[model samples]
Target: MYDNYAKVIVKGSPITKSNFKLFNVNGRAILPMNSGKYHDRYAIYEEEIAFNARSQNPSKVLDEALIAVLKVYYKSEKRHPDTNNITKSIFDGIEKSGLIINDAQIRRLIIEEFYDKENPRFELELFGESSFSMDYSIKPREILEEKITYNPPSNKKKALNDRMNISAIKPKISDNICEVCGKGTCKENLISANKGKTLICRTCFKKLF
Candidate 1:
């Protein structure tokens, strides 16, 4: 079986599906601006994953089925969003990023969550089609941790440190709206930002700083 793995460090508090509210626009259902903004934050990391996937030759379309396993470490000062919703957002982000041709190709999926103060990230493990049956009963994080710990890699700590060391930069302006405030629009340099993470309004930004 062909197996590949990737680790993505996510920025900001994890967004859940419940954070999104659908509203009508010209008789069509659409997500509110805030939800789009949140999802977009996570979407930026798609490029990072795509770049790392060069060696894996991630199939844009799968000839055979595969099982996808995801383990998420959520970082935040506040309580985290619901687990199911976090997984939903991750699935959407990965699909949009072309991590897989479609999430549907995944015959089996495993999800687990952990809390991290300094480094919040998601680790993905893709097992290529095999003649053997896929095991869905194992706890993803426990097994992964056991393997990593027993066969420790030298770069493990350094990698975690690098992900946690991201500094605040300027927030991008999209259609004049600050991604964080959702209400604040048309202001350039809304707030200090983290790469691939947050975009808040000056007001909220000041509050945090």
Candidate 2:
């Protein structure tokens, strides 16, 4: 088994999953085909990657178990493709490049995407079954920390679930109290804001607005 690394630098944007159109045939949802722009870019990627692989002059393709790890750095921040979608596109390109007999031979796959404003390219690392079993000591360190106020996809879903589950933990807006300002006002006349999560009297809402 072997461990190999190759870099492919291409000029165009990668195709995203959203670029395909869905058709309903016989009540079944089917993805008809990728858009023409996607095919065009993919063709270019295949050619460039194939040339680079040949230049590197690797050994004959292994017919045994294989694994591929891909790191894709995209150039534009304007378009964010699903990370998995970009992997699929590159996988096809790798297969067409004849770097391997078929992509189906790949068992374990990992793909990541990053943003690069000036240059967009993909770096791939291929590992054979034996190479993965060997002892390796490469530990990655985080160079940057990005702090976001909102949660990520998984945490966002969890947050939403928590919010939905706390239906009984509502603010008690008494008939004579404003929940926001704690002003004495008739509850029947208080304005319900933020989908009932927050209760504010008309005066407070008007003042804040």
Give the candidate number with the greatest lDDT: 2
Counting only residues 3 or more apart in sequence or on different chains, how many pairs clash (N, Cα, C under 3 Å) in candidate 1?
A: 3
Q: Which regions in candidate 1 have their CA more than 4 angstroms from the true location? A: 1-13, 21-63, 76-78, 136-209
Query: Model 2: per-residue lDDT, tens digit, 136-195?
Result: 356765685675363457758988888877755655445456677788665766888779
Score each candidate by Cα lDDT. Answer: 0.57, 0.63
The C-alpha TM-scores of every prediction are 0.46, 0.50
> Ten consecutive residues with minimal summed lDDT in candidate 1?
143-152
lDDT of 1 by residue, 1-209 (tens): 33333334444455655454355756753444345476444444444444544434445434356667677777853457667776666655566556566667668777887778887766666665664356544354644443322322567967765666643233333445656557745456555457736667777777766
Off by over 4 Å in 2: 1-12, 21-39, 55-60, 134-144, 148-209
The TM-score of predicted model 2 comes to 0.50
Estimate the overall C-alpha local distance difference test score of candidate 1.
0.57
Question: Whole-model lDDT, candidate 2?
Answer: 0.63
Top candidate when judged by TM-score against the true structure: 2
Clashing pairs in 1: 169-193, 176-185, 176-186
